[model samples]
Target chain A: MSHDTVVTAAMLAIGDELLSGRTKDKNIGHLAELLTLSGIDLKEVRIVADDEEAIVEALNALRARYDYVFTSGGIGPTHDDITADAIAKAFGLPCDHDETAMTLLAEMYRRREMEFTEARQRMARMPRGAAHIANPVSTAPGFIIGNVYVMAGVPQVFQAMIDNVLPMLRTGTPVLSLAIACPYGEGDIGTPLAAIQKAHPDTSIGSYPRYIDQKFSTEIVVRGRAQAAIDAAGAEVHAMIGAIRRKKEVVENPSAEA
Target chain B: MSHDTVVTAAMLAIGDELLSGRTKDKNIGHLAELLTLSGIDLKEVRIVADDEEAIVEALNALRARYDYVFTSGGIGPTHDDITADAIAKAFGLPCDHDETAMTLLAEMYRRREMEFTEARQRMARMPRGAAHIANPVSTAPGFIIGNVYVMAGVPQVFQAMIDNVLPMLRTGTPVLSLAIACPYGEGDIGTPLAAIQKAHPDTSIGSYPRYIDQKFSTEIVVRGRAQAAIDAAGAEVHAMIGAIRRKKEVVENPSAEA
Candidate 1:
């Protein structure tokens, strides 16, 4: 079957703090979930250092491969925040102060009555021929140059910008998922699960084991775009699990009636 | 100031589920932290699909560039789990049953009195010249071929294997950090923080803003290997904040007692 209809996106998280273990990158999970719900498939995620070369390489590769690329971090007022410059270099464009971005920066400083220094004005730099992404919480707006969308690295500000930006993008058919969990090991149900996948070729069966309260249990998650097929596959899984549970009960207490 | 005595590492997460937004790859954070604690700098992280060609390409590039390369996932009993095969292809070695890995797998199945099928036996395959990595949680052991370490995809199992394997490798001096959060806006502290970073070229200072109860507060984090430098930098940061707070109090009660 042709899977050409799926809209794919990639995430790039740039910072040394994440690599140094000083900060945990939380944007990956939040963006992945947001894209999934919007029917956009996240195809790849890369975390690179604050260095210019690393960011440029990742940005070029992902932008060429995926339909859309979203990047977080290195967009603040500090000298180390070089995401805007890196994106410009990757796309072969000049990094300069855009009037649109400068307007927003000036408005924010004017409201606070703070003297905006040249260091603070550094936030207004954007790649040539790009649009600004609105930041509802903070004013240092993220910008989109071609397929690469660069935003602030901080989780709260990044999330707010995503919420404002995602609605403007095109989406594909959304994926649906069905799940079942019981006290069972994956090996005992592997054969039946494989058979279900073969019958419903469009669906994917994922087996995840959860350890809760020091007890092991497995959750069988089935995902597809078709609802009827999902129900049919889910029914087969339940029957197979019921059979195994009954057989175990019979062996444990031979005299007990079911 | 030659900072060239640093051991660097990169993590490659191989799984389509992570890319497809079905699973959040937790191993990257855990590995990043573990590597940093071991004094090995985690420089980059990449998450790709289970495709052999992609895995092989990433394996070659990262292994050639970094001091150490760690890969998680795509090493399992299913048809798509081809990490061992890909590593063999990257190294131009034959993929076959490793004697040590086979012994460990056999002992594990024997303890539980379970029959090891051909599918389960697939876990024993490794590169021709690779060595086995100890898996404390399960029998499907990880392997180390050259600079690359191939481990399980599951979080708990991979973490246990890392703890067992990392001590055997050489490490560098670990990094240290100090941070303080105050009720101040980033706009108020932006200039002074920039000055602190400029004054101390060896220390890296980061500013993070959080919105709590609809008010913005910023956290200033400073990091360095030297204790004396960090103490001096932290004192300057506090002094700056004290000055800002005092100004705010004076502006609020201008006609009160001096």
Candidate 2:
């Protein structure tokens, strides 16, 4: 597959619990960080309910737009676990039990002397002509159909599956970031920061404010694939903050003591 | 404004930091929970980069689909903050500094002996014919244009603005939920649970699995507006779990010693 200059991806978080606000989503952040480190840009994320139409629409939209689309949740044994079927429908394929997945799951249950019930067998189903993604935590494997990779919603299982999935995908140049903490509010240095950002168009500068210990501060981060550009922009940010602080101090307490 | 029988909402989280995996989002969960408590259904959520085109495209889609759309982040004083502009363009309205918002911010800065810089004044800009949403944390207020409520990405300010915005909107009947936890995996009782779900079409049932203390368990939640319906479904859920456990025990521990 010919990839773009910047390898990009999108995430689809499918579940009624997440939309209902009953479950605080933990997979997106984890996946985002992992993808960044692996040199894949996470461009978009859409959280939809377990409804099949919602999942299919989002799956098609994301898979067509990005290089890869990863879906979390709704792959369990329960009826609400409908991501496999949705992905199948989105790609115009039939969903059924896969022999490899069934063998893996059946053996795992047999080793534990547990009856593999029909409901347990539901986890072995996958879209036709799809390859399974190994699950380190549980034997029920996730599968990949087209550019869409389906994984579990459980954080541990999701992370484990990501470990298996990342090596299979192509990686691009990783983005390097440098953070500089300034003891000033965002408003104090917003103008200079914008100028610095313009001076280095290759690097993306971000300003995040923090109000802790009864003091206001901002953390400015510079991100890009080039280290030289990041360093140049980071130095400009440091100098700008110093200049602002010095000007504020000299004007505010200009007494004979100076 | 009149709302549909189901007052649905969509959230747009606008920021480069979120997409870059530098910041873990907190506002979505907070808003989802708050909206649910206020009898509003949060149906969809989209996390997009700070790019104006992306923001505008998502805003139009979400606002068109849902009853209300809430956006968080990118309303700060920095150059990266383009939500106000994107929102204005989405509605084909003019973006400018509102007299009311300017006065609120100017007065707050004056009282604190702070200079209201041009960058700080950027927070006062809103789409024409917009209503400002009060920000108790910082004087830089959010705004409401059409059905979209734009608020700060900072969790503190976002929560405060939500407290102000909820009362102005019409609320529907709240959905009450009951949870029943069983010491078994989802597959252990998924078939019976689905039967229960099919039997009670009015209630929405969610199954979430957990692995803690080296034990597997699943929590089944039933949600609806009617107490009688929830109670009836809750009883079935309890009985189904009991029956599953009893059958498993009888099959595993069969003995004629008794």
Candidate 3:
């Protein structure tokens, strides 16, 4: 896509468990991968504790800066689930139990013969004018309010919300990424790779280093919106890797020429 | 720990791979858990793309707000690896090849019979007046400048750097945590849990819900610095869960009196 056609997004992950290291976040990666596939650039991500003020501040900052701000966590039925209220205050809207959400919860509870207690009812609350994002995994729906998508912290629920939300949002031209593996490590290829990157300013080349079986290996990923740009960069990186491999082989056996 | 004695930290993860979901971040979880165990509250985490301006802005913001700011990624031999340069700019310091780091790299490369090319030499560069965080997994070193720590993106290197850096930082009182398992889900226990939390404001109670075997379950964690406060809040939460379980059992089987 053209630079102006780029659709950018930011994610805010809200939970004390995540900040405390009690819960390893799975949603950020899930959301990021999906967004990238759908042609939205996940520009930034912020993980904050379940404090209301922090949520409000992050929500406001991210919502204003990106095309969409997707938040995971803090929408549960428990007391610590303050995301809905925080989003409400951030947008200067009243958060209350929405009749649509309340009805959804009520029906789900009745089918299971569970009481729709006040705690459960809290899940039905969202910022005013918010649209519901259906949760196929769970009964309580996530809400979309003014470009901010507030979803559950549970990995399954978060992914489900993304499934619902992705189809409805505006997406850019998908980013094309090609990965080339090289036996050479970063130290062996950094200079040539940088030159190739300089030659292809329109593409982004990333060098990922790995230690495998006591040998250093690297993966070169060339990403761009246009296929022609990606193909050009990828071919150059592959050729560079081959050249480095041959050079290293000749250095190891100087008598080969003789 | 008392409020005044609390030591707080923040983490900045710099890499396009992370934002692109090409890399699932392992450093954030490892750092968060270790910091929490070390009596440092990891208050926030930010993941930014490999953009120098983004890194500089996040570094300045986090370094000023928290006692310590830990960063992972972008300190590599490749061109995309610009974290050290960005950090230098953020702190208004000159970044150049450190004599100690260069010496270390030179000696290691010589011993391994590998060329210390310009690309390899790039790893030796760091911000002026920065202290080295040794990477045992790799020869390259991370650096600490002011309250900001710049580390590698690789998981093994990042963990090794943490092992070297954690011992030197100030810490708060270790937070005490107690978890109680409950068969009932959050909806069944949210109200009473809130009451228990309010009754012991000094402690933090977190409700983590799970769906297993098509049934709802939850784990309640009570955390505080004082053992007494944790025990007090924990006891209340335990008692409430038991009460809810008993009530639900009776409600489901009304013929039990026979």
Candidate 4:
């Protein structure tokens, strides 16, 4: 029941497109999976627009509360990219062009034989005291300031940066889960589910109703720290579901004489 | 460059399965669309676990900053559902079983001839001085306390509740968008895209790179309040893309292309 040792993290998805529904925020799900695998509990995920004040507020609040904060978006070369400035304001620091970032970016442009315009150079600016997060895919590297790590809004780049950063993070014990799926509705098996939940107070029983093909099916998932308890609770759920199904079948097909 | 009047909102998605990667949180995208269509700027979104303290802290911070806050999940018959209690604690109010909620739930159960156990009755609890937000699809109704509206975690039920509650909300002028997509990578047209963005300071232009059918594609979206301005910007982008494509085709096939 006590999860005090859980190493929790938060996500900040910064984009106006996500808010407008033009683009679905895929970074949250990716980060959730990545963090869970790394044994870092993703306690919270947030999506904010390109606005400076909103970004700063969310950044400050999340960074203060969670062990680590990962932000995706508002780091591109466009005018809407304001994450670097906002992070600076959140930390009460000045945003300036980092020479190291500029040198790396300049080298990339030179190798590709592309002009390093002012707009492209804008990507080189970071919060005064921050280290660069390596982006293996693109030339524009993500940055980390204090507990907050800023990455690209693009899924592939963001994922690569996360993979690069996760190994260095301290993690806790990985979580384990067990589930019991049946061809029944939640209302039909609510009682037994409640009983199992009450009996195993340490485990969490989640009832999900899924519509597949033409039928409604329910999946009751039991998750906990102890594997033995999870197995026992899952067995109880299966027994209860089997009994209910058998009873219903008998009632519907009385004698099978026809 | 400046929005004279901005009515911002935040979405809080609550579920541990999401954090554990067992389930992807879909409520944020749906809520963002709903809020945007209603002319309320969905400025921020947060996904948190069923933990009470985390939910309470996020609720307090978001509700205080934004004009409205919409929270999904943790409002169920299960013990893990702690959204109501958290909201109450956040507002420094006492939570108890409401007579009105009980009556509504009892009616729903009676109509379906279902047993209304203590666990089922737990859905009738609400924070004091909160108005009920109607849930058309489900028996468990949501509640509105101050700026925060608490609803179910299920996508269909949550969306329906938002539809029911949105008509009554006061909203600002809605932002509109126009987009043009082509079968080319963003890297191919970064310079011109940057130029267009610089020219249209009022409009936010986003360049998204998508991989479809093993081919790279990019979608340039222009968003702003002015339809005429957006139309002009879209026209310029189309012309720029057309020129780029023509030049590429000419270079690749000098003899057959003509």
Best by DockQ: 3
lDDT of each: 0.82, 0.89, 0.91, 0.82
Task: Sort by TM-score, best first.
Answer: 3, 2, 1, 4
Q: Which docking band does candidate 3 fall into?
A: high
Going through the candidates in order, their DockQ values are 0.45, 0.77, 0.85, 0.39
Per-residue lDDT for A1-258 in model 2, tens only?
123257899999999888778899999999999999988999999999999999999999999999999999999988788888988999899999999999998999899877788888999998999999998787899999888899999888999999999999988888889999888888887888999999999899989877676455788989988889899999899899879877888778877227
The DockQ for candidate 1, computed on C-alphas, is 0.45
Whose lDDT is greatest here?
Answer: 3
Chain B TM for prediction 4: 0.93
TM-score of chain A of 3: 0.97
Where in model 4 is the C-alpha error above 4 Å? Answer: A1-5, A92-111, A182-202, A209-217, A239-258, B1-5, B182-202, B209-218, B229-258
Quality of model 1 by C-alpha lDDT:
0.82
Residue-level lDDT tens digits of model 4 in A222-255: 8776788799889899899889878777667877
Reference-based TM-score of each model = 0.89, 0.97, 0.98, 0.84
For model 3 chain A, give the 10-residue run with minimal summed lDDT.
Answer: A1-10
Measured on C-alpha atoms, candidate 3 has an lDDT of: 0.91
TM-score of 4: 0.84
lDDT (Cα, tens digit) per residue for candidate 4, span B83-128: 8999999999999888899999889889976666676777778899
Error of 3 at B72 (Å): 0.4
Q: What stretches of model 2 exceed 4 Å from their correct place?
A: A1-4, A213-215, A256-258, B1-4, B256-258
